[model samples]
Target: MLVDADDCEIVGEANGSAEMERLLIESAPEVVLCDTSPADALRVIEALSGEGAALVLLGEDHSEYQLMADAVLPGWAYLRKEADRIEILGAIRAAGAGLIAVDRSFSLLPGSAFPLADAEILPPDETLTAREREVLQQMTHGLPNKQIAARLNISQHTVKFHVASILAKLGASSRTEAVTSGARRGLVSL
Candidate 1:
């Protein structure tokens, strides 16, 4: 587990949002470290917000981009690759303590608009659990519970449980309703 002596645990690593989502669901890490393209990073953070893990975004340059991403969740930390170990460790500790730790570069762009600050459009109550989201995603494909269970390697009862949870979470009365609701809410597409 010793990738470095400074960090306590390696915890988990993810190549993309989908895999990150899985790891987060299973391990429930205290923080998530992601180095993603600017556009994709915003979407990933938005999708992963409900899990309570502080987000730490790592990349180089793009002060404005960091501002945009930081605005999504003030508790997140944005650090540059050139930052020293002390700074990096400090950011990690700050993020773990649920505080915002924006890179110093962002201060230079003081007048720059935090583009994503007011860009998130979802209602506060609309977020769904990872499982409910999976069901809704399957519903988007017009898949039946049996088919979904087979695909997810879960029992049919578990699939039914997920479907029920999806319906309740999405405020839909049926699978079709759930699919439509999910699509409209940007949770799924068909």
Candidate 2:
């Protein structure tokens, strides 16, 4: 018999995270096999971390959450949905033993969901912090510093600091130019 056959056979199947929750409580199997969107995977792992089972996440190679396996999945195993049978079995066994398992293909970049093997999508400004990226998201919306500050609940001065940093980093002489440049480079939405 396949070592994975027993637990894998009757594991819960849900097309989305909500149904997965109900399935988790009702079936309560030893393992869960799922194909979830990046955000959905985060939610499922958050919900199921302390439940009495291992979760084997199957996701496409480029799924964003595949990059944060450590932080999101404390004790679960995560692997590319395209793994061969042997590798899948190994992850299942490791997860069953209560150890977190990860595919070797993931990277260590914080706040970046891009896979290690792929080229990085550096926001024209390599020096920008993740917080500033949030600011840029608002800037792309044509919000002024005061409005961005109000929406982010940060002080206007802090927003100005980020704007100055963003200007210098992107080599833009003004916020409008920065927004235009950012939109061109896939850094922010127009």
Candidate 3:
């Protein structure tokens, strides 16, 4: 599909890890499309790291949440195989332009209807400390630092510290992103 896209140029395709490595080193394309196994996709992400090749990972029959969590850096996309052509191409373009794109298969907005799945979006690795989790929950309610400190019976300075910790643990740059990620991981609710 990417080969046919007007915005993309087909460089090389790989059938195995060795070939993929060769193609990556040789072609060094602006974006990498991966629709294979999760392991191979992870490898591709690793290979492209610091090389400026954005990754568009298509999850079919794998643990998508885990893969998405592992796709931590900017310029990474995690889309379901069911994504339409337009969605796929848009994600690739966005990633290529150094943006993080999450598939619409799950609405990850702050108060979207997307359910907290049976399992967490990320489990232990992104786990927040007890106090950090409290701050995150306050953040879910859109509480400011002063309000959170008052509610949690802590100093505003302490609240700020916990907020920073929550953002770091969740890999979020802002409070809203932390809340959304926390909701997806069943750590917080809207």
Question: Judged by TM-score, which candidate is best?
Answer: 3
> Positional deviation of 119 in candidate 3, in angstroms?
20
Tens digits of lDDT, candidate 2, 141-164: 889889999999999999999999
lDDT of 1 by residue, 1-190 (tens): 1257465477788888888888888888887767787767766777557667777777665543545354434467777767776776777778878886667665334333232433332456756767777777887888888999998888999998888877777677888988876655556545
RMSD of candidate 2 to the truth, in angstroms, is: 14.3
Q: What are the clashing pairs of model 1?
A: none
**How does model 3 score by TM-score?**
0.55
Instruction: State each candidate's clash count.
Output: 0, 0, 0
Which stretches in model 3 have alpha-carbon errors above 4 Å? 61-74, 106-190
- Cα error, residue 101 of model 3, in Å, equals 0.8
Residue pairs in clash, model 2: none
In angstroms, the error of model 2 at 164 is 38
**Per-residue C-alpha lDDT of model 3 across residues 6-36, encoded as one tens digit per residue:** 8888899888666877998899788887776
Assess candidate 1 and give its lDDT: 0.68
- True lDDT of residue 101, candidate 1: 68
* Candidate 2: 10-residue stretch with minimal lDDT: 108-117
Pitting candidate 2 against candidate 3, the one with the higher TM-score is: 3
